[model samples]
Target: MDKKAKALELYLEGFKVVEIAKELGVSQPAVTKMLKQFPEYHQEKERRKKENQEKARQWRNEYKKQKREQYDEDYELVLKSHREDAAALSRRGKLSDDILIKLCILNYDYNKEKERLVFNESAGKRPADLPRSVYVHKNVLKQFRIPTRQ
Candidate 1:
C-alpha cells in the first residue's frame, strides 16, 4: 500500500501519528505532511470522533434512565413496607411517642442526605421558590448539630 493509504488506515485504527510514522518507516513530520495532503482524511477522522462521542453520550443517558427507573421501583417498595410496619405497630398498640420520634429522626436524616446529594449534583444551584425561612431553619439546625430534612 502507498504511504498515505497506510497512514490513513493506521490513523483510522486509532494509532497516533508517531506510531503510524514508525510503522511506515517515516518521520512523524512526514506522516503529518502526508495526512495534510488529504483533507478528506482529517474530515473523516473528525466525523468518526464525533460519532463515537455521540454514542458514548447516548449510552450514558440510557444508563442514567435505567438507574432512575430502578431507584423509583425500589423506593416505592420500601415506602410500602414502612407504611405497613407503622400500621402493624399502631394496631398492636406498640407505637409509642419514642418510636414515633425515632421514626421522624430517621426520615429526617434520609431526606437530608438526599438533599445534600441533589445539591452537590446541581453544583450548588438552589431550587426555585425555596423559602428564606428554610435557610434560616437549616442554619439553626446546623448550629444545634441537628440534621435538616430535604
Candidate 2:
C-alpha cells in the first residue's frame, strides 16, 4: 500500500505521529500533513485524547483512594498508641477525661500536620503558612545550655 494508506492505518491503530513518521521514513510534519488529508484523522485524534484523559482521571482517583486508605491505617496506629499512653497515665492515677480528649485532638492534629509536611516536601514546595525558623528566646536556650540558631 501507499505511504498515505499505511500512515492512516497506523494512526487509526493509535500509533503516535513520531512513530508513524519513522515507520514511513518521513519527517514528522510530513506524516502529520499526510494524516490531515483524511477526514477521520482529527476525529480519531480527539477520541484518543479523551480516552487518555479518562484513563489519567481514573489513575488519579485510584491513587487518592489508596492514599486515603493509608491515611486511615496510619491514623488508627496513632490512636492505638495514644490509647496505650492514656492507659499508662491512668495506671499512674493521672489520666482524666479532659486529658484523653486532648490526646485525641493532638493525635488528629499531628497526623494532619505530618500529611501536609510530607505532601509539601514531595511536591518540592515549602508550606507557605509555616515559618522557616522558629523564634525562640536566646535566654531560654542559654539557661538550658542548648545551642541556638543564629
Candidate 3:
C-alpha cells in the first residue's frame, strides 16, 4: 500500500501524527497533510478522542471505588485492634465489661484521655459524688464521633 493507506491505518490504531511521521520516515507536516486528505479524517479523530476520554473517565471511577474499599478495610482493621486492646484490659481486671463496652465505641484518643483523667483524679483532684465511669461515659459521648449517634 501507499503512504496514505499506512498513515490511515496507524491513525485508526491510535498512533499520533508525530509517531506516524517517525514510523513512515516522513516530516510531521507531510503526515498531517496526508491524513487531512482523507474525507473521514476529522470525524474519525473526534470519535477516537471521545472514546479515549470515556476510557479515562471509567479508569478514574474504578480507582476511586478501589480506594473507598481499601479505606473501609482499613477502618475495620482499626476497630478490631481497638477491641482486642479493650479485651486485654478487661482480662487484666483493669476495665469492667460495662466500661469496656462503652470504650469499644470510641477511638484510641478517648481511651488515652480517659486514662489521663483517671490518673489526674487519683493523684488528688477535687472530690465529686459522681463515679469515674460516669465521667468517662459522658466524655466519650461528648468528645468522639460515635456511629450509633449518627
Inter-residue clash pairs, candidate 1: none
Query: What are the Cα lDDT values of the candidates?
Result: 0.65, 0.69, 0.70
Question: How many backbone clashes does every candidate have?
Answer: 0, 0, 0
Q: On a 0 to 1 TM-score scale, where does candidate 3 land against the true structure?
A: 0.49
As a whole number from 0 to 100, the lDDT of residue 34 in candidate 3 is: 94
**lDDT, model 2:** 0.69
Q: Supply the TM-score for candidate 2.
A: 0.59
Query: Model 3, which residues run further than 4 Å from truth?
Result: 1-6, 13-15, 85-150
Model 3: lDDT to the true structure: 0.70
RMSD of each: 16.3, 16.4, 13.3
Q: Candidate 1 lDDT, tens digit per residue, 1-150? A: 998988988887788888988899999999988988787677877988898999999999999999999999999999999998878687667664444433433222212432221122233444343321111233334533445479
Candidate 2 positional error at 74, Å: 0.9
Clashes of 3: 0
What TM-score against the true fold does each predicted structure earn?
0.46, 0.59, 0.49
Ranking the candidates on lDDT from highest down gives 3, 2, 1
Candidate 2 residue spans exceeding 4 A from truth: 95-150
Per TM-score, the best of the predicted structures is 2
